[model samples]
Target: MIDTADEFESACRILAAASGPVAVDVERASGFRYSARAYLVQVSRRDAGVFLFDPPAIGDMQALQRAIGDEEWVFHAASQDLPSLRELDLVPPRIFDTELSARLLGWPKVGLGAVVERTLGIVLKKEHSAADWSTRPMPQSWLEYAALDVEHLLDVRDLIADELAETGKLEWALEEFADELVRLPKPAPAEPWRKLNGLNKIRGRRNLAIARAFWLSRDALARELDAAPGRLVPDRSLVAAVVAQPRSKGELSSLKEFTGRQSRTQIDRWWQAFVDGRATEDLPAERVPSDALPPVRAWSGRRPEADERIKAAKPAVEAHAEFLSIPTENLLTPDHLRRVAWQPPEPLTEDAIGEALASHGARPWQIAQTAPIIRSAFVHAAQASDDTDESAS
Candidate 1:
């Protein structure tokens, strides 16, 4: 294990001399800190054994960056680690996400442990899953866990690459990797109040207005306390509080509805704000429209002919996916399948269908095999729907 800056630099020099790909894995301090930062990074090369780099000790990763920056770096679930890597100003030119690659290749389990076991015939221990990676002077077991992550990644990649080539799906994997490199992490928006479970049932504009105010107040307090919004004040408590409309601290306290930190820290302030806000508001309570909710469809209750078509198409799609060594979901999502079953687009020539499939990220080989069947099934569904509509009219 490489711990100090000098050792890390020396390892980078050795890795830089290699022409093949390098396996990369990162361990971050996620739960311990509000921001995700890499505490440790493990790398493995074809000739070189595993090496772990301590980000804090190294101070700067310029040498390590230069080594792996140009080569195709393989990672499992790259998105989670990409943000922390970007923070250090390290930009990789070529990237391959083994998880995405496995999913694309129809592997049921895409996790690193599972992939390693299945593809490389190695069973990785899971003792370090919940360990504190931020702790200094890393434990022996943790180091082993970290080492195992990248140790078999290169071998796994080789096996998957062969499968991709045999199935004529190598281009799909390349396209996915290219797409992965351009993605960046985005901050989640502050909309805690909007996620209330059943707030829509409360009658009137006034209820919604008060609920909105309460939600904003709760959010502000949560942020101030550095606590999760639900931890600060649950939606149920807020909804109940709004319904009761407590006029004072005593009334709010008497309700016995809230306990813990929210009651002790925020109830009095929240009640006062609600009372003060209500005095100026004159809007009547309004009922939220039921139609605004997402429509629920019963898959089994659909028209028999449509159901038959969908059922018939499933095995064919699965077979094609298996033959291509890619997941069936990657070819088309369930939602897309439903759309094709219920409402399909107009007929197109084979070439146009192939182009459309390719544009949607399907490999050339996949398009060549599945496009004709998909297009025909969709056209038939559309015509049938049109006929039914005309007859009803």
Candidate 2:
């Protein structure tokens, strides 16, 4: 609730004086707002207390940055919060992601509420987890809930750290956490409109263009009003409008399926999108180019050699993972293994396989474990093929 400049300064000073890594959490109005902007940011330190910050009220967060910028920050799922946190200039020097830590340590439940209750025996009411944080005159109950998020975080972190050390996964967890800190934001998809639900259900290039127009128009309006696009017009309504082929704004407004709070009220806008979509020279293509490989299950009929390599290697790799007491996917991502098997680099030694895995963003620890297994699998598959051919001849 520290909104004023004076209160912010006081809060920063208090945080600066506090000891240990800062526990941080962000509350974003994901479904209710247009942007993933942080409605509230909560920070906790050892000696100091929990502080709830209103980002819209406090425009400049560099002061908070200066206060705790040098200290390591702790978050449950740091990746999910980093984008919103960066928007406020609240980047951390280092971060310990409890979620990643739990994953590495093979903990069954990694959610903040579960982690706290499991480790510290505190049952937090999670009713407000999905509440619209953009609401004004913050409820007292919400404030208490927000405070509790960071309340036992540091304690839980300490407990988890000990468990990680006991299981010989502390270094692995640290490596994962460090990687999580520097994870680049995924690039925005080229034709984000193509992601709309039931988009494929509508066919023809003209219809595709109409859908594109609808998405763009809706996006612009949503950005302007700072409201979630779905709130103005849901995806189903847009698809319906395109399918109906409304003759005029009147027809568009009258379409029963084209229903939203602003659907009829903004009839002119919706109608224009349809008109432009029909007349424009830029019709959307049916399919976009992709570099993604076929699913692993399809490798058998597509590439028998790759199928052989994966079949020989995957079970062995999985067995090792079980021996190590880690998830198979965590040890080496299934896709990374499949890609390497499909098109393995020539001179496929352990080192060569390791390099190929590295090119696909595998961590050093993962490459170290799986490269030998992969090399052996490929060689074994090749030798088995030679033996079968010899027997036939």
Candidate 3:
């Protein structure tokens, strides 16, 4: 509950004096704001005690960073928090994600709250789950909730780590964490905006071009305003606005869907941008071509047989998964099953099939359990298809 910068620095110093791994949690206003930045950071060390950092109050995070930089910190789901921590230039040398550890050890549910409760026999209060962390003069309840999140994280990590070691899955957990480190966020393609609601009805390429222009304009405005992008211009309104092709501010404002600040401040520039965008003639075609389906050769034409086999095998797979208290998808993907159902059975050896599964990231134990069923399905399909071809000849 300490709000002063000096108190925060002293707390961080106390944490740095700890001998073992630290546990961390972050509260961010992502959907509530234009920028997905951490508004609060909470950390707890083995001996020093729990600390909740108000990111706005302590603008510089150098002290906190230097303290935890070399320590083996444990986070429930590191990937989500790592990015936000990176934004603050606080990079930990080593990280163990408890959720990923649980998944690697074949836990049924890997959610933070679930893992923590299951591992430590403690229930977390979710009262502050949706609280806006960016607000100044933070509520006492929110501070308590934030502290509680990291308080038990070290205990959960120790329990999960011991479980992983006893189960001989420590290497597996390490591999999973290594894989997570490389999966840092990358920007995605922008074309999928066409499939957004109402935009699909705007048939021509010109209208789509106008929509793209307007969408980009709104994106920039949202960034500047530090508001959610949708608040600046909703997807449906953008579509409707473009479709109307309003040439003047009055006409733009007259559209039933356009209202509030968008109708006032946004109308003129948006209209101009759309009009300018429409003037350009070489916009890409709005509609995805009908001939875009993969070629017949690319499709495993044994889809019907594959479907039947998978449907028949699903119950057994589910039963096995339930018996083991794990998800069926973790054992074998539907694509793997379908591929096995449609392939030739020249390589009848289980080792060969196991190797194939390994290539697709299946664990050795998973391949060992599911290889027999997969091989049998392949043999059955191969025999059936061969008989049909022989009859035709």
- TM-score (all chains, Cα) for each model: 0.71, 0.95, 0.78
lDDT of 3 by residue, 1-393 (tens): 556789878987888788799999889976567887889999999889898887767788888988878888889888889888888988887789998777666777787778877987787878878776887778888898899889999888888889888977676567567656666575654564554567766877787788777777777787887877776667777787787878676888788887545646767777777776788776857555542333324455636555444544556666776665556775566555545444423466678877776665666667777877666655565577778889999
Pairs in steric clash, model 3: none
Candidate 2, superposed: residue stretches over 4 Å from native: 390-393
Candidate 1 — which residues are off by over 4 angstroms? Answer: 1-11, 17-19, 29-32, 54-60, 131-140, 184-326, 335-347, 350-370, 383-393
Write candidate 2's Cα lDDT for 192-221 as tens digits.
Answer: 999888898899999999999999999999
* Model 1 TM-score (2 dp): 0.71
Kindly give the stretch of ten consecutive residues in candidate 1 with the minimal lDDT sum: 287-296
lDDT of 3 at 348: 69
Cα misplacement distance, residue 215 of candidate 3 (Å): 0.8
lDDT scores of the candidates, listed in order? 0.72, 0.90, 0.74
Model 1 lDDT per residue over 1-393, tens place: 576877887899888887788888889855443346678888899887788888877878888888878888888988777778887776778887888878877778988889988887888887787666788888888998999889988898889888877866678778767766885544463544556766865566677667777777776776675555666666777777778877677776677665545766666777865765466475533533432212224444745555645655566777777776667777655444444444333455667656665554555655666767776665575577679889999
Between prediction 1 and prediction 2, the one with superior lDDT is 2
* Collision pairs in model 2: none
Clashes of 3: 0
